[model samples]
Target: MNLLDVRKRSLGVSFNTEGQADIYVWSPIAKKVALVLPDKNKTISLAKEDMGYWHTSTTDIKPGDLYKIVLDDDLERPDPASLAQPEGVHGPSQAIDVNTFKWTDSNWNNIPLEDYILYELHTGTFTPEGTFASMEQKLDYLKELGVNAIEIMPVAQFPGSRNWGYDGVLPFATQNSYGGAEGLQHLVDACHQKGIAVILDVVYNHMGPEGNYLNDFGPYFTDKYNTPWGPALNFDDAGCDGVRKYFTENLLMWFRDFHIDAVRMDAVHAIKDFSATHILREMKMCVNELMQQTGRTHYMIVELDLNDTRFINPLEEQGFGMDAQWVDEFHHALRVTAGGDRNGYYSDFTGLQHLAKAYTDAYVYDGQYSPHRDKIFGIKAENNPGKQFIVFSQNHDQVGNRMLGERTSQLSSFEMQKLMAGAVMVSPFLPMLFMGEEYSEPNPFLYFVSHTDPELAEAVRKGRKAEFAAFHAQGEAPDPMAEDTFNESKLQWELLNQDPHQTMFRYYQTLIRLRKELPALRQLNRKQVEVVPNEEQQTLVLHRWHDNDHVVCVMNFSKTAQQVSLPSYSDSLTKVLDSAAPEWKGPAASPDQADSTSAVTVQPESIIIYTNHA
Candidate 1:
């Protein structure tokens, strides 16, 4: 079944069997709405319907037609739900037949959340060519790296060629620089063929400041609520059903037309909707219905800073019931434990105890008072499954948002990097790796944008500096408008063949493979894991087990070798993995010969793992 077969198509350009196009747009305040066909030099007036939707039918319009809407015949604007804005944000919208692209993977089923080892990459910076075709060429490499899913950063049509893609104005249009709609479809098809699921990042918080035409057409923005970008979207206000329907259909289009397996909703906390059912809940219900009809599993992963478990809780418990959400607490706890600078948000995460808490308890701030925000932060997420929280050591936001955009490879020693990698891959939560993190790519992922408006460009430069000022770094932020900054952020793929980089890359590969092979490690139960933190020695021990099978991880955060007392467990043990092993470019040490009462000597700032021998 296709997108049109599942549910009635909402606000967009849809074609019928006779090649006639039915144009439906919602503009309650506009006294007049007309479709202007530039190629044929014809105009068709749409009659206003009962609920503020303007309707018009025409047989002359077909796929690949270039058209625009005239509001009251006095002003012109592109469609808010445009599929292909080939001419950029200021140009005409292009018609597309969603059913044209043929998919080869008819038997593709969704990857279960427990099996996801996600790899996130920005489309423009992931490769030298930085297009969809270029991204497709690297699928073999990603598959070999043992990542089952690729979480692409937002690729919705934005202002110019270079952007993080959060500033997209036309939500439906694919960026022209990245090969447009056909390009995205090609990447999706290729991913499915390689047995990899694609998770697209989407921004629903606010529209970008540039080329925003939604407000001109109707009451899309509401002054009733304020957001960091602008006024909140009109979700519960008058004529908001149309606004909700526009975004809801957009979500379904990605799944139905593009065959996307999942989506990572960007900053869902900022989507303030006071309706009886929030927008996130509505999206869950809509995707559920779509899944039932098509027999294809579709899921939503949210990026929420609020640390509320309600987002992943079941709907019957008065929660939103999302599939998963990003857990920043894990990053904060792990980063600080690895001797990272304690500044800004990092100020709140202190001591090695937090790391142990993260392993046993789902969140460290479960109802605890936060000194950084001067209030209690987060609720207990213990009831939820471990896979509901996605954890990453290095990601786009963590790297790009930094003052120098330095990755973990730049901040810590090679052994410490291996320790961080071990913690991420071995934990019960879902794991994700930023591009080039497996090989320790040196190039920084700096923030960059290519806005045509000089004023907006200058504002962006100043805004980035002001935003990072609280960190009190020594140097100024990189200029967002500078082409050199964008060039510097691209990954150096050649480093994978070098000495230390190659060793680190192999270490990550081994860890991912072992995690998959070990049944005890694959389980996602918090109760099955035990955290024992020795604060005086600056070391932590995590014991994970399932079905009488057990694995223990001992980590040393201090600068000197320390003897870690093995936890009192009845199972016999043998060393399985070690960060300080000579093969991983670490100091050589013999394997531990110890019972439950004996202690094992660990190298400075390294991790060692042991599995049950019985």
Candidate 2:
């Protein structure tokens, strides 16, 4: 999946300098294959090649030309490796020349995972226009907010327009509704120019239920294992080499072609790969080679329910070699402590001690009893640095999957919200902020999808309601097929300039700045961090330091004012940042000053940060 491997392949339509193109496709079941060039109004029968691959070279094809492949001279299908599906999934495929577009980010070096301050956003709902170009305009604002990287939800082509992008069918093509491939490249270029790395969330577990034509081409799916979305992909089954190559090439395309700094593989636990070399390991080796050649740091983060460190451990240690994985244990514990709605998975987490456990260890349920699942869950994430886990109080799944799609800002009090923010930013693990979290945007992130098929749309609606039945929310879930639902998810950008919203925004800005300015706060080593929680007082003190430098974050999870004591340390602790300060629109109840040996009175459900200054 490197440039050399890409140059050797004839798959898709690769245009050359002589105005000629080489097209290659692998369809084992087909007896006849013909290149149908609608732009030239001609059809050329392709010659059969080795390994069920059909190939044809001709000068008739050009960039932006519409084409399809004819099977047995009767049925025509879009290219399985289509670069641009601007005219929807069922429409004719458009040939796009990726090399033609000039890139301005040749000198861009990607930010490492250790320094990552990720802001997760959905392209369609991030801005009012809901396009990549509109997202490009907001790069400066994100830069000012101190976010070093942006983790975008999938942009791969899905059915109709309004989706979470999880149901993407076309791996190569960017979502046409989000400005297609060129727009994505432009957005990536703009982000790189402003020192912001782009981490794309990709769905490799299963394709969407609609517009999935891979089965028509070959055995891209298998009946061996069933997935939540559909049949599992053919990773270790027959004809899996080609399927693995297809996905591996797609990963390289994002990194090499689109200049994406990283990729967050969605729901990796669902991808059942039993091969000797797992698909993730293959991807890791491929990405590592690309990094060595390009001298750019590219990360491969995965979303897995399993808290196994093998995913992020070193390859020499017989591991998968993934850069990092999403940690949901912290979010669940924080949600339960902050008085948020606890249902289903939230039932397993309780009390302020759970939060402390998540801080000391990456997961609270590491090989522990889980009442929710009625069994033991998760393995110890040993030998892995805390940076290998991405922690957040709220994400797309935690918010949009709810019946009301209420965010943490809506679920908890203003002081509780500040406390959660303090815990996430100062924690040892990497931090991710959901879109509009900085300003606490009032709008909800409803689950919306615009499917052309009515039957499928109705099924999705019913499924969503059934998923949230256990939460026992007040009213019925919003209709996923409603255009209003998608519209309601858009961020209210103007609120950042308003009264309380502006204060919340400043609070986040200050926290991010402090996280970056302090060297002791940047380390992700759990051994360097200490967490002490008082069950009776419901207060948690997170202390992270290196050598003589120390930063302590004291959080009161109680609903009323309380005096939280601190044990004496090597140096006196002075107040550095207080979430209850008058400037941050708090109750202005913070103590005047503090020493490590004394106690400080904290307002209801607030956070106070102190540092040991020599």
Candidate 3:
């Protein structure tokens, strides 16, 4: 058999000379592997030794070549690293040179974390057209709405045209429904051109339960521990080096090859790796090194529920060294203030103190004793010193977990909703928004999947029911695979013209602009936060402050209007944002010019942002 040529400028595979291919695949089931080039080029096959290392190459294969492999003549498969999967998941792989895709973002410095008012959006549901090209048209509008970064849900190839994308099985292949990798590239290019950063939400902890063929390759996963989806990855096992590299390399690819500015590592705490050092740490160092080389500030952020501060601290200091972590405290506090209900994890956060803690400390549970977890959960985020925690009043999980998938908007009045938006944007920690939240789009962001396997599809539907039933909160979970779920999730573009929706959008935009312009609000110092908690009044106020140049953040959580007297301000200040001033009053509201500080009455369901005018 003639040997097929394999060479890459990438870190993974390389074959420098003809007839000497350095071929590597994860396939373990195959006893013999042969690389087959089309057009009767030759019967060149690679030699195999030391666990799936198929080598030996010839000049038969060249750039722009199409190829498939005879896996022990048992199964014919496509190249794992195929740059183009024109034939879909079950078809032949098209090899293309990565160097040829012209990048227009040579000068793109990543948007900083502090600057990111993240918009977490699901692509397939983001627009009626449901394509990246269609989505690109809306970039200007999002830009106008003050979205600096777009945190897109996962886009790797899954089974069908519709999915929330967590069901992705082919990590290398972009979902065909979204116009594949090219479509994503167009979106990235458009975002870069518009000075908007793109952060992909990647799931590497566990593969989707269906259409997963990694096990056919080798011990990609082990039964040592089980994830809700499937088996956990075998990161520490003997043959796990390549597996770890595969995942890490893919992450770097998102930054390097695709020009993605950042990655929102999904549920990183679920990523169990017990190497001498942590895999996450290694991944961070690797990406940071790449950023240094490219002169860009690509970041690795994580979504960890572990409440472990170590995830955000430096490696030497014994933390995970992530650029940032989502502070659930912010979400919890905001939820309690807006919704006034405590169940599930919300059980830990009840009343105004929790909301105040979230306002002051960024994490409501920071260093607090918790009855929910039984043991103490974490140290105050202030201990981290100089970092920004991401806060959101409503995110995908909180809304979708409901049996009815009702939005926070559904549970509150127009005034209350506006007030919640104010509390979210004006806080010390950096802020984020779920898509459709700013406009208060009256649509539900439910979990949706399109699995080809009927049995697998049924399981997803049933699992949704069971999970929500355990909560015992609401009945009738949205069928993620249903056409209605996808249809219902799309933003009602018409809502922008509605009074309350338009008002809220403008209000949100104002808060974001103020956040950018305010010197005091720009401070990422978690330690500098001060909370004045009022349990009896159900009022929580905090100062995300610079003493000499001060800013005051006040929140009112009651359903009805209540006037409260507060202590005088430290410095002469003007009211910068009143969430209840009809609409879009951020930066426009002025404190009564009588005194710099005084006992003032706050209306019910209002948030006041006072900025020093001195």
Candidate 4:
């Protein structure tokens, strides 16, 4: 039975029957369980069951009742099934009637996976105000730029004022410093009011080093498995049923209670689950049930490093039901092409060939031998994937985790920078941009966290430096624990008026318009994308096809000027956007591309998109 459908809602209680009221509090560790209604001064001792679930049928307990679980008559705490945390995590759990909030999106439907253009932004760093309402102010800008969804970094409560938001300690509560819970609701309502979907990033594997008090209650973590963060959840151990409920409840809380449309589960591989039905599978099942309950289609995305296709594959085919995953192949290839650093995974990717292959095929090392890992990596996804695949040129991890926390534009030439923007928008995969990427804001996007403990802070500081040193020989690394790290990570919003920044901004907006308007560029559930390489030159041609119409993309990846010979096709090519063109004022100077130098005299770096005229 759905407990939410019951009439009366009280703290530290559950229904005895469909129509009867009963107060319940299970204290396995407590010698005696007492349900104290502080409002009425009514005290009732529950008869503890063999399973330790304390229960009592009391007619006095009614809806909107306020009570707390008295643990051995010493400490009282919020209910584990708290629907609302009006007073934050350490306060009372309000009994919220699920059907109370008046939702306005009755006929609203989310855009298909293939049709998504995501803009990933951290709420705290996006604006000076650093709240949900602050980002809400930019809805018109996103709509104008053609971004359909805003993928926000984790908003769950961590420690202190500023953070990356990934190491969320309280899974159910919104960050108090970032305008708290009511403010977040306002943001979601505002986003839906405008035509945008909101995707939240959630970490289920491990909690922050501090403020994570789940262990104080029971065996929420286990030593059987370990994660980089503090402890792996006890998903397979004894008394693990409640652990599963904790995560599943958090998932439903986001979608149903917070009105969040989608969630990006952080690090699925880190979750240690040996259950018959895995945690990921259970999550998908719970989400499916929520969809049936709410009559809304919500999406669950996985951020996996395993590079397994079973995530998006069908359940009958022995796959986890993930809507999509972040494809690092495309991101790595594009980064190396633009930044030209082969320190880490970039070692596997070098020239324009890999970049071309990545844009053409989503994976560059698909089941291929790898020298970096000394093992074969990635599966051959030559066949079609039903779920959508998300890709971005530069994201928080790529830019922030760097040895100096440098952005692409900080290192690449202006010409190359604009080409990167052009390349990102025209690509077939679902494109996402980290905040300030559109206007080329020079924010560092560095990794920042607030740990009050001195020892933990020092460990994080030393760990970050050592991690980078392991990958590269020598480089100036940012101080992970310094105040400057957070200060530098904030977006410099006024850069919109700058010359090259404005030009690139317009280029991004134009490409977004094209992605939304063009049918060929839209994501259709199939593998209809193709990449044609110029074997001898640093150029690649890409094509995305619909029924009869086709969208063509050409990329120039050299440091010097060169001629690129055009292919002889029946359809005349209409240049839709040219990064090296004068309107964008690109530095490229390719006079003609069809010459035998069969050459298109291309500048140092550029990308060109043209419409096919049949």
lDDT of 1 by residue, 1-614 (tens): 11223464556677876777888888889999988889999888888886678887788778999989889989899988889898899899998877778889898988999899999999999999889999999999998889999999998889888899899999889898999999999999999999999999988888888878998888888888999998998888887877887788889889988899999999998998999999888888888889888889988999988978888898889899899999888899999999997887889998588988888776889899999989999898878988898999989999998878898888899889999999888898999999999998888999999998999999998898998886665688889888888889888888888989999889999899978877778888888998888888889988888888788888998889998988797776888788998999898664755558878989988888888842
lDDT per prediction? 0.87, 0.86, 0.72, 0.72
Model 2 lDDT tens row, 1-614: 11227323346887877768888887877899988888688887888877777888888888989988888888888888888887888888898877777899989988878999999999999999999999999999999889999999999888999999998888888999899989999999999899999999999999998888888778898999999887999999988877888888888888888889999999999998999999999888988887888788899999988877778787888899998989998999998898875777888988688899999888898898889999888787766887899999899999998788888878887878888999899998899999999988889999999888889998999998887776664778889999999999999998988878899988999999988877778877789888889888888888889778888888988877788777577677778788888888788757656776667888778899888762
Angstrom error of the Cα, residue 136, model 3: value is 0.9
How would you encode candidate 4's per-residue C-alpha lDDT over 260-313 as one tens digit per residue? 888898888898887888888877877887788778778888788776776777
After superposition, candidate 1 runs with Cα above 4 Å error: 1-8, 469-473
Q: Candidates 1 and 2: which is better by lDDT?
A: 1
Q: What is the alpha-carbon lDDT for the whole of candidate 3? A: 0.72
**What lDDT is reached at residue 20 by model 1?**
77
| Prediction 4 global C-alpha lDDT | 0.72
**Candidate 3 C-alpha lDDT tens digits along 60-171:** 6665566776677666776655555565555665544444456787777777677788999888888997888888999999999988899998887777777777777767
Q: Candidate 2's error at 153, in angstroms?
A: 0.5
> Cα deviation in Å at residue 602, candidate 4?
3.1
On lDDT, who's better, 1 or 4? Answer: 1
Give the top-scoring candidate (lDDT).
1
